[model samples]
Target: MAAGIQQQNAAEDIVIAGAGLAGLAVALGLHRKGVRSVVLESSPERRTSGFAFFTWTNAFRALDALGVGDKMRGRHLQLQGLRVMASSTGEIAREMDLRVNGKLGPHEVRCVQRNVLLQALEEELPPGTVRYSSKIVSIDDQDGAKILHLADDSTLRAKVLIGCDGINSVVAKWLGLAKPSESGRTATRGYARYPEGHGFEPKILQFVGEGFRAGLVPWSDTDVYWFFTWSPAPSPDANGKEDRSAAAMNQFVLTKMRGAKVGPEVLEAVERSEMSDVLAAPLRFRSPLSLLFASISKGNVCVAGDALHPTTPDLAQGACTALEDGVVLARCLGAGAERGFGHEEGEDRPCLGDAIVGAGDGEERERVVAALRRYAGMRRWRSAQVIAASYAVGFVQESDHTVVSFVRDKLLSGVLAKTLLMMPDYDCGKL
Candidate 1:
């Protein structure tokens, strides 16, 4: 009762599945636009455990549009830039500064905590905005509304439905989008603490070794976030596969770091990690080209966030893009969250389409459909580019081939630095 998180009592007008980063942010953004939405989380409560991420300028613009920029800006430190190092020699491979004053003015890059970002957006909503323990098992479209059949045997009719549910999303499945394919690479991410202070400068430190790549970002005075990504050697037998257990994963990272000859101080974070803190998983992403003609929306039901496009974390843009999805989705919906509202004749911006009410069935459906289509169209190209670019970057960085390494370390070092700088220049536009 004290917090805005609440249980749903009946059918909701606008229903968003998955109360993670995208669902919550989209719901909140919609709230700012005077559109009400209910977020359904499959968990029993607000799940907050997550590693930190590099929030680039595009993410900050999305946060500002969502009206929660200051809350996060106060919590994390701004990183000046990052240094990519060659693991064997501990020599800098590429050093890129993030202080570019380009397209969207000066840049803003911070290694922000995922839990804090989620909680900040949640606090800005009214009670009952999010319905935890709510899972949509199946969905279907009737006359105009999408009927969401919950796991608890109840149902909610949504005038407009957005599937922010992640990778294995039921809504996305219902829309018949292809399942995300797993890349050959895997990643382990966790945090390290140095109470007296890590004594590291305000920037990211990365290490590249053969098929393994790792990086560390110090976000606070006491805590540092780190991640290691590698392509596991293909095993002929199932028993030869890498262990998926947390303890095993922690040991694997330490062993790999030692074998790579990474500096003692640099590998200290993994060695100091609690077995529980070290988490690992195989990277997965959608085939970017499939999205070109994907069925993202059918009538009033559409997808966003991971449900829309789950990109690899190589670009450090998974959550950042999710934040962007929220702002763009809400902005496009523009008061069209309510049914029977159509834009007035020739109105450029939305908001229930010029307050047209008592419109015919087609008119009402067109307004909602149009809004969803606009959002899907606007985000499709951006998501595809992210998915494609992330995989390409990961492939290049983690390639252990002799020729590839020579090309990367010799020919493309400057290009790597430039690409990093240019990635965040994208502006997600205003609400």
Candidate 2:
């Protein structure tokens, strides 16, 4: 669509799959580095319909790293604190103050419409840099680079290919990474316009009950996005508590929020917004591996975003981490550095342009393997730690175990949350 955006030759600079936040972020990062890239999105165009999403200061830091922090801040309603409560009792279990961390710029967390974020990211890309409706059917590893075969029988080649495709990424397997694991539970996310007099404060409001937890986050002065995570219902009679069938989901929601603080207006808004389609599926994650792909780089080939690590939404860090990975991966390559394997800076280093340019079939495979191994070593543990924290969050917010739940919700709520909100201070940025 744009000059230098065509997929005709095998010598293009970089090709990124999936134009989600992760993909778009990577494209922007590459552009910042003066590297040209072409982003291929399976979605016909930017998805305008969806729920609201959360963005913590930690995520904001990542966004800042990519130079779009202020733009996002202008559009979102910065949350003052996180309110965790007992779902069944509606009793306040914990309250973590945003000011405690000092990480968030005046406010602690921000919620914005999912489509809004996507639109902001899309606007940053050079026009035509994104090719929608172009799904990647296959990825072939060449001697030094990777070739992407599209669904329409077209092909594109680049010095590097990143599979920013989501949890059900086809590129990971195509590139020989491990398959996704069967996550234990499912999540249903939706968005609705915040009606007048909803009575809910503009904060991250969570309700944890006997067997389920629902979160309500305000994305703007007039709208909020909420989600209900629960175990599948025991019976088929759709009353809305657990199953994802349209009727069942609707029924489940109706029953749960029937008398809760969600209010009649909010319920009416949710019903009026959209109900035929919802993002409902069992959560999944990659096995705790040293790395996602066999190697981070196969000669000039590499993977990024969920294509590398598909985490649960319990942490709300999936999109954040993907954006972080996209930025960091590009930095490592741009700086001509590779971690692990005692890779040192040398005059004629393999990580530099030499290996990329002279790589033959055999040498290319070996180089790619080495890069993948190195990439795994650099990122696996950190990703696992985040995943574990997210699982712990799920437990603290909705554990069935009585004693454990009490301790998690009561004893650990305030102090622990304060500590975590400051975790963005860690040096996860840069190579």
C-alpha lDDT of all candidate models, in order:
0.80, 0.64
Q: Please name the candidate that would achieve the greatest lDDT relative to the true structure.
A: 1
Q: Give the TM-score of candidate 1.
A: 0.91
TM-score of each: 0.91, 0.82
Compose the digit string of candidate 1's lDDT tens values, residues 1-431.
22322334355567899988899988888888777778888888877666788999999999999899988889999999888888666677888777878666888899998888888999998777888888888886655566788887777767678899999999999889989998978888888899999988889888875788898889898999989899864233377765777777777788888887576766788777777787777889999999989988877788888998888888888888999999988888865644434222343433342212223446756777788888889888888988998888888888878888888887887876766666678888777
Q: Which runs in model 2 stand beyond 4 Å of their true positions? A: 1-10, 102-107, 195-199, 233-243, 257-273, 276-278, 289-296, 337-378, 414-427
Clashes of 2: 15
Q: Candidate 1, which ten residues in sequence have the lowest lDDT sum? A: 349-358
lDDT of 2 by residue, 301-328 (tens): 5566777777666767777677677676
List per-candidate RMSD values in Å. 4.2, 5.5
Backbone clashes for every candidate come to: 2, 15
